[model samples]
Target: MATAKTRQKILQTFLDLLSEHPYEDVSLPMIAAAAKVKLSDMRSAFASKLQLVAAFTEKIDTAVLDGVDEDMGDQPPRDRLFDVLMTRIDVLAAHKEAVRALHVAARHDPALALDFNRLEVRSQKWMLIAAGIDVSGVKATIVAQGLAVAFARVVGVWLEEDDEGMPRTMARLDKELDKGGSFMKRLNGLERAAKGVRSLLKRISDRPARRRPRADEDDGEPDLSDKAPAGA
Candidate 1:
């Protein structure tokens, strides 16, 4: 078998083990044995357990992105995102138990959770792009991050969605997407407000300041302090 095939097998075996065993107890040797690859060759696939999980996420992300529907061009942004996210859920459905196991691990491991979210955000950026949404600049970053968080929540619902058709999961995703849309609208409003403030500040700064009057150039008003009784 090719090296790539062997490596993929190791990853799959690790996830399979993860589904059945605790992450802290799963061993590389176990993965190697289960994958039917020698420990020596398995070392070439993953140096640590976390690396195996990262590779799994990358593989799933690639699969979801490859399945993007170009026919969603005319749909609204939310619909486009809905379709792509559903496709992602489809790809994840097979690994539900493995994912549930990881979620349990993450809840107890802040460092691992943060690291995993880093990868998840990257995946969400591709999802945004695949959905025909803009993934550029600060706005793109904000949208992608919001989608990452929302997607995680949606996946949590998906893991328990025994209905096969996933109606409940779809409703949860729709609600989350609507929440994200509202947030994006607010963010855009803030951006617009910020731009307006910046323009106003620039205009103020560009206008020449009025020169302070020196001891010279007084008006024609009389010195009332000394001459106030002149008329009297």
Candidate 2:
């Protein structure tokens, strides 16, 4: 329990620092100092800043998953997804500055952007499952990737929209989800088409091969006469 608290403290301290500073400006030593832990102890909890960020992301994912509304089970998939994503934004409201900082850093750093994308896609998969949406097969990954991008845009709007009701943020989210739903329909159609093509090719490949008659061979024709040839 002490170890867990220490880890949480480290993460919290990092977020606080991130909120006040750019991602590039925050360092491991700074987090250790801010958290009042030994540098070695901080290292034991997290090896690097990226890992710390990833751990923070996991913490958020857990919070969102745990808070999933059971009553949303009967809701349409899009509505369920909207609720889940809005819940995420609500949870992230406290750390808005930190998210904004990371967003800015990621725009300039290709490596950071790529790393964050992986984390976003993974978290989006869980969100999809929470919404009772299918996350199976390769198309599921495409769906997740699309959601991640849409969610990022929503977050961008969220950071800029100061209105308490977040009218703009909600509006943007609704629009993105509508676009995503259309894309999903197209993806499903393509997947079905691909499956049909694969089935046809398999059937063709499984067929028995027909052999051609050889030049010197008689083509299974029966002899009319029962007697042997005169030479015989």
Candidate 3:
């Protein structure tokens, strides 16, 4: 549709400007002019620069999600993750310079860096799910955050890797994922232990309450045996 095209153009124009200039230096008006849309049109498409950046990220997420290979269901988790992440990088290849420029800006801007991390964490959740990884609870959030940080490192290598096959980037990703898999194993152990404790507590709390022993029916001892543990 026309609206979608305009939004895409605005985002592309912003990226093009970022490739040529610092992210801090690119303004909404400049993007509007470069995109050939009126100020109002640009506003209608995106409220601010950060939102535009988030939209661009969502675009990449969609591309990567859509491109997931169904046949990879039988692949090892790490291999599937590698395929998903590499697909992400390939989608991002067209705007490599823009990404590099944004990274430079983030390095100097704490706010931008934090914002970028938040977006990356969100996107990495989908990437994990695409790789058939469980993203269900607090542990899944930690995993996504860790993956986001690791993928950022891979992208750092990728930005400078010029070899046709990107050997360096691929190697870095493999190392990162290998490390991450070990971390996940440890984390899963802890999660299982925690779950066991919670289940035990739940079982203790759900036990039936015993009736108070009547004076006439007293068996010589107070019947406190069926009480749930304190704080259960």
Can you write out model 2's per-residue Cα lDDT over 103-175, one digit (the tens) per residue? 9998999998999999999989989998999769787789999999999999999999999999999999999
Q: Choose 1 or 3, whichever is better by TM-score.
A: 3
Estimate the TM-score of every prediction: 0.83, 0.92, 0.88
Worst 10 residues of 3 by lDDT: 218-227
Whole-model Cα lDDT of every candidate shown, in order: 0.86, 0.92, 0.92
Total backbone collisions for each predicted model: 0, 0, 0
Instruction: Give lDDT tens digits, candidate 3, residues 73-121.
Output: 9999899999999999999999999999988988899989999999999
User: Candidate 2 overall Cα lDDT vs. reference?
Assistant: 0.92
Query: Which order, best to worst by lDDT?
Result: 3, 2, 1
The CA lDDT at 184 in model 2 is 88
Best by TM-score: 2
True-vs-predicted CA distance for residue 162, candidate 2, Å: 0.6
